[model samples]
Target chain A: MTHLPYIAAAYALAVLVPAAYGLAAMRRLRLARTRLAALDPRPARRETRRETRR
Target chain B: MTAETSAAPGGFEMAPRAAMFRSVDALSSLATPAPPKAPGRSLHRFANPGRFLRLAGALQPWLTAGGLILTAAGLVWGLVVAPADWQQGDAVRIMYVHVPAAWLASAGYLGLAVCSVLSLVWRHPLADLAAAEIGPVGAAFTGICLATGSLWGKPMWGAWWVWDARLTSVLVLFFLYLGHIALIRAFDDPTRGYRAGAILALVGVVNLPIIKFSVDWWNTLHQPATISLTGAPSMYLGMLWPLALTALGYTLVFAALVTARTRAAVMERRIRALLMAAAAREDGAVQVAA
Candidate 1:
C-alpha cells in the first residue's frame, strides 16, 4: 500500500483541527470582549465589588 | 451565550414591556455607580483580572512567534531531512507529528486533572475556567493522535483501527474530553456546570495512567515507548532529533493555546458576571416602581 495518502490525511487532520479550534477561540473572544465592554465600560468598577466582599 | 443588548439611540432600547414600569428608567442611574478601587497596600497581583489580561496580552505575541517558528523548523526537518526507517520507509515519518500529539493528549488531560483538583479543593477561581477552556484543545490533540495513529497503522498493521489496548484506551480519552465539554455546558448556571465538570474530570483521570501503561500491561499490537528516562533510547539519533524538535514545538504550541484560551475564558466569565449584575439592578428598579 502506498503510504502517501495515509500520511497526507494524518498531517492534514492534525493541522486542520488545531487551526480550526484556534480560529473559533479567537472569534469567541472577540465577541465576548465586545459584549463586556458594552455592558461595563470600566474595568475598575468590578474592583469595587471585590473590595466590599473583602 | 450571546447577550443581546440593543445599541439604540443613547443606549439599549428597553423592551417595550420594560418601559411600562417606571423602574426601567432607573437603569440610567446605574450608569455611573462605580466600584471603589482596592487599597494601594495590597500585594497580591495575579488574582487581578486586569493584571492577568495585561500579562496575557504581552506574552501572546512572543508565544505565537516562538510556537510558529519551532513548529515550522521541526516540520521541515522531519519531512525533508529525517531518514526513513529501514522497515517502514516513509511511513515512519508520521512519528514526528504523531508522537508529539499523543504526548500532548496525555499532558493536556493531566493539566485538566490538576485544574479540576484545584477548583474543587481550593475553589481557585481561575482553576475551573482553565479546566473549562482546556477541554477543546485536549480533544483536538487526542483526535489528531487517533487519526494519525490509524493512518500509520493502516500501512503497517494492514488495518485502519483495532480494539488493541492502547488504541482503545486513547479512544476512551477522546470520549472523556467530549464528556467534559458537554458536562461543563450542560447546566443553566455556569457555576453548577463547572462543579459538575470538575467532578467528572477527577473521575476520568483513572484513564490517564491506563493509557500510559496499556502497552506494558497488556499484550498489544502497539509498540512500547521509544523514549524512556531509565535507559538509552532505541531510536537512531537521525530520527531522534526531529522527534525532539517537534516535541518542543508542540509543547510551546500547547502552552500558547492554553494561555490564549484561558484569557478568553476569563473574559467570558466577566461578561457573565456583568450581565448578572445588570439584571439584578433592573430587578431592584422594578421593585421600586411596583
Candidate 2:
C-alpha cells in the first residue's frame, strides 16, 4: 500500500527519538561522573557526607 | 602595640583587649561553621539527592529491562501477527507507534506539573531537578507524536497538515516543553531559574485538559479518544492489547530516562557545590597567609 512506508517511518521515528534521548542522558551522566571524580580525589569520602545527610 | 611594649604595662591591662578578641573569634567560628541546611520533609525519604540517587540507581536496570522487553514484544506482535484493517489496510499499523507517543506526551507534562508543585510548594530538593530533566524527554515525545501524527494524517486525512484543535494544542504543548527547558537554564542562579520554570510549568498546565478534550470541544477533523475512563474501549481486543503493551513499555522507558537524568543533575549540583566550597577554602587560606 502507498501508506505502508509512512507507517514504517512513523514507528522508526518514534523509537529513534526516545533512544537518542536515553543515550544522550547516559552520556551526560558519564561526563558528570568523570568531572565529579576529578574534582574530588577521594570520591568515596565526599559521597560519605552525602550518605550521612540521607 | 608590640608584644614587648604591651608587656611593659601590667598583663592585667590587656584583659579587655583579650576578651574582645575572644568574643570576635567565637562569633567568626559560629558564623563560618554553620551546618548545611536540612532538606524538607515533604517527600521525606526521597527529599535528599543522595537518597533519591540510590533509589533511582537501583530501579534503572529493572525499568530498562521491562521497557525493552515489552516494546519488543508489542512491536513484534503488532507488526507481524495482528491483521491489517479491511478498510485502511496496513496504514492502521501506525497507531501502534502514534498512540503511545501521544499518551506519553500528555502524561509526561502531567508529571512535569506535579514536580513543579512539589518544587514550589514543598521545596523538595529533587523536584526542580526532576522537572528540569522531564522537560526535554517530554518535548522529544511530543515532537514524535506530532511528527507521527502528521505521517498518519497524510495518508488518512489526505493532508499532511491541519490547524485542528487537537493538533494545535499539542503543538502548543510541545512549545511549552521547550519553553520550560529554556526557562530552567536561563539564569546564573539555578534556584532562580528553577523557580521561574516551576511557575511556567504550573501555568502551562491549563493547556493539558484542552489537549485532552480538544476533539470534543471543537468541530475538528481529529478523532475522539479511543481509550476513555468513563466508557468501554472502542478499539478491538487485537489492537488494544498491543497498544496497552507499548504504552506500558513507553512509560517504563520514560521512567528510566527521567530517573537517570535526575541522578545526573544531582551529581552536577554536587560537583558545583564542591567546587564552590573548595574555592572558598582556598580564599580563606590566602587570607590567613596575608
Q: Give the CA lDDT, 0 to 100, for residue B212 in model 1.
A: 82
Model 1: pairs clashing at backbone N, Cα or C within 3 Å: none
Model 1 DockQ reads: 0.39
State model 1's lDDT: 0.72
Docking class of 1: acceptable
Question: What is the lDDT, from 0 to 100, of the residue A45 in candidate 1?
Answer: 45
Off by over 4 Å in 1: A44-54, B1-45
Model 1, A1-54: lDDT tens per residue? 237888778778767777787687777767776677677778734533443464
All candidates: interface RMSD: 2.9, 1.8
TM-score of predicted chain A against the true chain A, for each candidate: 0.74, 0.68
| Least accurate 10 contiguous residues by lDDT in model 1 chain B | B20-29
lDDT by residue (B1-290, candidate 2, tens digit) is 23432233233222322322222122122123233463443244455555555556656677778888888788776777777887778888888878878877877887788778777987776778888988998899899899999998898899888999999999999999999999999999989998999999999999988998999998899998776655556666687667666766777777778777887888899898999999999999999999
**What level of docking quality does candidate 2 show?**
medium
lDDT of 1 by residue, B1-290 (tens): 01222122112111211321111111111122223464332222244567666556566566667767777787778877988888998899889889889988887787788778767876666667778878888898899999999899999999989999999999999999999999999999878998999999899989988988899999999998876545566788787667666666676666667767887878887887888898999999999999
DockQ (C-alpha) of model 2? 0.56
